[model samples]
Target chain A: MAATNLSERRLARFWSKYGFVLAVLVPILLWFSIFSFGPILYALYASLTNTHSLDPSRARFVGLDNYISLLDDRRFLASMSNVFRFVLVKGILNIVLSLGLALLLERLRRGRNFYLFFIFMPVVISQVAVAMLFLWLYDPRLGLINYLLSLVEIPPQSFIRSTAQAIYSVAIADVWKTYGYAAVIFLAGLLDIPQDYYEAAKVDGATRLQTLWRVTLPLLKNPLVLVMVLIVIDGVQHFTMVQVMTGGGPADSTLMPSILVYNYGLGANNYRMGYACAISFIMFVVIMAITVFQLRLFRSLYD
Target chain B: MTDISLDRRAGGSLPSGGAGADARIRLREQVIALVTHLLLVIFAFIAFGAMMWMVLASFKSASEIIAKPPTFLPEAPTLESYALILREQAFGRFFLNSIFVALPSVLLILFSSSIAGFVFAKFDFPAKEVIFTIILSTLMVPPAVTLLPLFRLVSRLGWADTYQALIIPVCVSAFGIFLLRQFMEGLPSELLDAGRIDGASNWWIYRHIVLPLSVSALSALAIFSFLANWDSYLWPLVIIYEEKMRTLPLGLAYLLGWSSRPRYDLFLTGAVITVVPVVVFYSFFQSRFVRGVTLTGLKY
Candidate 1:
């Protein structure tokens, strides 16, 4: 009876602790379960169905047809190609430009904050606004790029209006808007390296370029991977700029996967809900795969 | 701050009181530094030049803006673009919509994530590790993948175009909880011990002790949450259907319009409207913002 009584008291104490844990965890869990996890699960299910309308309950299961159909979809194919191009070009520019700018900023004695403010300003602005801003900058006749080109004695080029140049133009605008963020992140990483390392390198009579290659780059491995991963994930989700500035224009040149999904699932004349989900999942798998590959590639290189 | 000094010393820019060889090396280093300085200055101007161009264009007449060589400066600067957008277009409505969606979403994430962080940091409960890991693992689930079902889920809840649709789905961030927990881990547990020993309720301890101590993290997360929600595009674009309900980004996108005609000046003005305030706000808390990005790197 005494042992039974002790066990009962233990149970009560367990309940009290569980109560506190539940109070905090339940809301977030409920939120995640309902909004995040549930929806993703729902998306998986919907991908197998022909759910065109908003009411997903009415969706009829069509097996793997939606997935199969996406394989042959021309626009979807175009979007994937666009995504690969974007990831490649944007990825290279981010690392090179940001690292270069960060090194330069690190070397500067004054006006670091001012430089940061201007560079990082685009990041704070909504993508919609940036897209709109660039639309003007990419204007065929009067845009900033062409105007600058003319001043250099080069003929004005129809940037976004031309089919061949449209996607690259869009990508360039995006690179400009986002590279500042990479620079800032790299700068932070640079700042955290112990100053003593530099002094030691100085004592050894190392050149700035040599020391940077041997010391700074090596020290920056983690931050570099982090920056690369972050940029990849963010870049792969490219939609707004394509949508607003070009709208996958000049013959579907800039139609990214996200834009493709939005177009199919939500565009006025197109509402292939089932197919959209399938495409989204395809893109999801692609993003995850690239992320894993990037991390492993960096690990092999540095570690 | 150390970056500057370390770089100077590393380059041997300041002579170490030496002979002919050292002086030549210093001169070479000085020349390199000068070149680097010139390059950075040019880059800075070009970087900030985008904003300068936008602001200048916003002040120019439509004809003046698209002139052959283009007006570098507005010869007769006017506020007509601003007036046109605000009065004729629905710029003001879209601006308010963004605030409405962003503010609530930011606040909700802060309150829930902070409290959750506190609990995760302090409490020893059943399944704590497993549960925390589950939450952390889901952080990588891209929003793009969930777009379809989320839209349907919002539709089912009868909140398709409402601000609630925007607020509810994004209100809880796994990343935010994880970040705050990392912060709370550094707090001396004894800091809350006094409150606990005094027979105060857990809520009271969390509110009076944990919340106050976690202000720095909270503020950092606040900026992140706010900026993130403000800059968000696809979700708002998909969820919202009504014209007046459009957020700033959506409005700016539509200003490009489905039509062939381009209105550069007004579009630039609208862009400025959406961008200026957030940039100004960020300027005030620049250090916090930098620290926030750095903390994100450590998440790896």
Candidate 2:
């Protein structure tokens, strides 16, 4: 009987301790149930339907039709191509420029703080504001860039006007806005390096370039991976700048997948909700795959 | 700072100081460093120059803005564009709309995340590790994936164009909870134990012991949340159809009014107005921003 009483007391204490935690778990579970899981499930159902935003009552089930049609959509193909171009050109340029700036900032003797602040200023500004700023900068006639080009005897070219150049111009604007963030991250990594590595290299009669290549680059793996992963994730989700600056204009040359999804869901006259859901799902899978691969890559690199 | 100076001396610069040949090497190093400074300064100038040019253009006449050589500084600065933005457009309403959306969202995020963070940090429960890992893993999923479904859900709830549409969906941030949990995990357990010994409930301990201790982390998270909500454009653009309900960015976009003749000065003015508040807020919390970003890196 005494043992039985002791067991009851223990059970009571356990319940008392965890009751609040169980309460907290309810909200979390509900959140995932409603917001996270609910959305994906709804999207899945929508993807299998021929639902239109304008006429929700006439919805009918259609298996994979949206996905199959999306494959043939020229605009979707163009958006995919545009994303590739953006990821390659802007991604590579941003990394190189930011890394160079990081190295240069690391070498500075004075006024480093001021330079850091100034460089990162653009990043703190809203993307919408950045877009507007670039709109002015990309102005054909009165813009500073054009004025400078004229000074060097280069004729003013209309940026953000030509179908071929609009995406690249947008990419340039994005690179300008985000490169400072990458540079700062790289600088943090550079600061973490021990002086001993460089010292040993110098003792071995290594030149500055050799020391940098041998000591700095290898040690910077973690932050490099982190920055690269962040850039890729952000690059994949590029929407607002494209939406505001060009509106995916000049024959849809600047259209990214995100903007395409938004257009299909809301902007277009037809409002194909099912098609948009499929696109968003594909985007989700792509990002998840990239993220998983990156995590594995980072773990291996670190190990 | 001292370590850097010591490293500079120990890296053979002292020996170089003793010889004429070393003097030339030192001079060359200085030259290189100077050149680096010049390049950095040029980049800095470009950033500042762009901002200044926008502000100047906002005050210039439209003809002057588009004229040959492009007025570097407005020949005669005027508030005409500002007046036009305030009087003819719904700029004031947009500003208020942004504040209404951003402030409540920030407050809710802070309150909910802090409460959740405290529980995760201080409590011992079954499947804790798994739960935390799941939360962290959600960070990898890009927000774009949820947009369509979220839109559908919001529409279903009839929350379109309302603050509830904006605030409710974003109130529970995994990142904020994760950040606060990391911070709270570093706090001493004894303080909480003492609070418990005094017959304080979990909520009481959270209020008296945890909240005060985690002020820095909370403030940092607050700044980030505010900036994020303030800058949010696409989501608002999707939901808000009316001009008066639009945020600053959307308002600025529409101020140009889908017209062939874009009003350059008013657009610049609206852009400036949208950017300044954020700039001011960031400047005030600059150190916190650095500390926050750096801390996240370390935690990772």
Candidate 3:
């Protein structure tokens, strides 16, 4: 009887300890199953059928039709190419400028935080507000940018007005808005390089520029890749700036897939939910591919 | 840039006659330093010029804001636009809606993720690794992919256009869970073991031991989650159509068209209201903000 009682007490203590862990873990897993996992599965199903969002049960399957039509869509094609163009040009500029700024900032031992505070100031604010301010700046008649151009005796160029200029204009605004993030990340990376590397470079009497080119940039591969991946993500997901500034055009010139997906999926009176899901899935593939590729490259290079 | 620095460090090592070359290099470095300062000043101007321009423009009359050559300062400063925005534009309602959505969203995210992260980090359970991997992989699915179906589910639950619609779907993030989990793994296991040894329950361990020790990470995630929800545009834009349900960013965007006129003063004013508080808060706690963002990039 005594042995049986002791065994029962040991079993009860075992349950109490491990059981508590399950209690915490179980709810979260269930929540994810319902919210996150369930929705993705539902999205896969929605993409295969013409599902009205309000009445998803009334959907009928029409596989591959949405994807096929998407291939034929002019606006979608334009938006894809536009995003690629924007990402390529803007991505390069952002990386170069942010790296330059990071190097310059690393050189400064004083007033470093002050400059970072302002450079990062724009990014911390809402993108909508930034777009609004740029609206003032890009205005033809009374804008500050045009006024400055006039002072230089250059003709006032219409920004965010013509189709050709619109995408570049929005891209520049976005680069300016977000370059600080890349700069700071680069700064963090620059800071992490051991002093021995610099000292050894100094012993070799390597010029600062050469040392930077050889030592700093080479070691900076991971952060650079990280910055590139982030910029790619931001570029692919570009929406609010485009929406607030151009609304995808003077003529769909600045259209991004993000805004496109949004308009089709959830815009007023246009509930082509199935088609939108297809578009979203395609973009998801592209994003995941880029992220995985870059990350693998970075990991191989760094580790 | 390189010459002057070396000279300073190795000045004593140089012979006395090399002083002339050193001075020349010094002058060169001075010129370079001066140029750097000038460029930085210009950068400062470029960085903050537009924002400051908006603030000054906010105080100006509509005509003055658009005046030729543009007024540098308000000829006559007024709160007229602020008053109108608050009274007519329903700015108060939108601000409250943002707070309503953001506060609960952060609270729920913090609550669930911290508890979940603690267990995932400390516990040895069945299929824990596989389940954790599944949750983390879900981070790759962009919100766009989930938006339509999530909307269907939300509307089905009778949450459309309500604050719950905004809060519930977004209250959970794989990224938050992942971030907290990484932080939790770094925590010392001894404190938790001690708590357990003292007959403290798992809830007690998380609440009393883990939560206090992980305060910094939690604060970072707190500010992060709040700002993300506050700045969220897409999902809220889709779900909330009612004027009363709109958040600050959406309200400001709506004013771009919905205003009787473009109303530069009013537009700038609304933009200022939407952007300034968060920016100002961040400026004061700038270190915390940077740490949070950097953690996102540097950590998993």
Candidate 4:
């Protein structure tokens, strides 16, 4: 009786020590399991089978068929190439503009926040809203851009209407919306660098350009890597702005893989969930590969 | 502050330089400053001007919105577009639905993340590192990978067109948990220990001590998560079939298909309605939003 009572008392102590932790963590982990982990595992399984979006129970195993077909699939190829161009255009413009803005902001003696407030305003709004604004701005007939171009005697351009300019036009609008975010990140990274470094560079009589190249850029490697990877990942998975602006239109010129996934998985009479999942997995692998490549590249460049 | 010293250092002349050279250098610095401010003002104007144009366009008449040589200011500014959208599009319902989904989701994320962060920060438990790593790894998986499966799951649960469909899947953010954990770990443990010594329960100590001290991090997370939920589109588009069940973004997008041709007037008005509230909120907590960006590097 004495031993049993002692063991019960120890159990009570253990419960008292860990009850709250278990109560909090159990639900959260369960949530992750149900929502996060479960869906990922399900996608992996569904990608290998012929599944319908509405009727998963009828799915039949089809080994590598979807993956093999995607290799030659014209639309899939277009999406892959389109996303490649999208990431490239977005990464270059976003970096240059944001870095320039960051440098400019870093030099300001006053009204820094005021400038940032206006610049960062776009980052906070909805992608669809931005798309709507740009749609009007890019309107062939009534757009302000065309009107301004007419003032300069430049002919009106079909921004999203033409196949060639559609992707770049969408890219430009996205850049306008997102560059400020990278600017803020770069600005934060800039401010974190010690002023003593600049003073040291000055003592050596390094020109402004030399100081920026040898000192500032090297010190900013982390944020640069961060911003680049984010741009790549975001650009690769981009859907909302493109979907809202064009719905991958003007002869599939801007058909992103995410849009393809939606078209295949859920379009009326096109419930090819398995095919869509295959595309999603490809996108996943591409994002992972590019991200790792970027990290490795940046590491080698600076290290 | 640092700029002041930098300016002084730049303005200070070489010991061998004459007064003319000093004047020249001062002129050069002033020219650089002028050019810098000029370029910055243009950049700022471009950024702010587009949104301002969108706002002004919303009030113009339908024909004037798309009129030739587009009017910079609405010649006859009116509330007709707003009245049309509110009455015909049921935007008010969409607004309420957005609030209904976002408020609960943000609150739940905060509660779950902070409490879990508190546990991870203050407690020693088995498999803690393993669990945290697992959660963090999920951040790398893009939402597209899970889109189909989640749709399947939610539909299976008979939750399509339900508010829970919007709220539940996103309620506990991995990023939020990670952010709050990083924050709560910085909080002084002595305060928590003092509460413990006073025989307070872990819950009480978290409620009174950890929660209060974590206001900054919590608020940042709240703003970000709230914005994310408010701006979410694809999920709501897929799940919500009912007009009344739409979120703001969804309702705004539907305005495009509502008319045969592009209605710039209604589109701008809907956009104005969609964007103004967040911009207003952002105006108030502008620093927190910026800090949240640096803190989490989240792009909305």
Chain A TM-scores, one per candidate?
Answer: 0.92, 0.91, 0.91, 0.97
Residue-by-residue lDDT tens digits, candidate 1, A1-303: 999999999999877767777878888899999988888888888889998845456778899999899889899899888888877888888789889999888877777877777777776667777788788887777687877787789998888888788878888888888887788778877876777788888899999888999899989988788888887787777777878878887788888888888888988877878888898888788878988998999889888
Better of 2 and 4 by DockQ: 4
Q: Which is the leading candidate under lDDT?
A: 4
Instruction: State the DockQ, from 0 to 1, for candidate 4.
Output: 0.52
Give stretches of model 3 more than 4 Å off: A1-14, A296-303, B1-21, B259-261, B298-300
Candidate 4, residues B133-165, lDDT tens digits: the string is 999888788888999999989998999999999
Q: Lowest-scoring 10 consecutive residues by lDDT in candidate 3 chain B?
A: B1-10
- lDDT of candidate 4 over A1-303, digit per residue (tens): 999999999989989988898999989989998999999988888899999998877899999999999999999999999999999999999999999998988778778888899999998998889999999999999899999999999999999999999999999999999999999888887777777788888899999999999999999999899999899989989999999999998999999999999999999999999999999999999999999999999999999
Please give, as one word, the docking class of candidate 4: medium
Query: Of 1 and 4, which scores higher on lDDT?
Result: 4
True contacts kept of each: 0.65, 0.52, 0.60, 0.65
The candidate with the higher lDDT, 2 or 4, is 4
Model 2 lDDT per residue over B1-300, tens place: 101210122332223334556677788877987899889989888777788888888888778877888778789888888888899887888899889989998998888788888889999988988988877766665566677778777888898888888888888788888888888988999999999889988888888889999888888778778877888888888777777788998888776564587667777889999988988877776666655555554221
Please report how far candidate 4 places residue B73 from its true position, in Å. Answer: 1.2
Candidate 2: segments with Cα more than 4 A from true spot: A1-15, A295-303, B1-21, B297-300
State the DockQ of every prediction: 0.53, 0.48, 0.45, 0.52
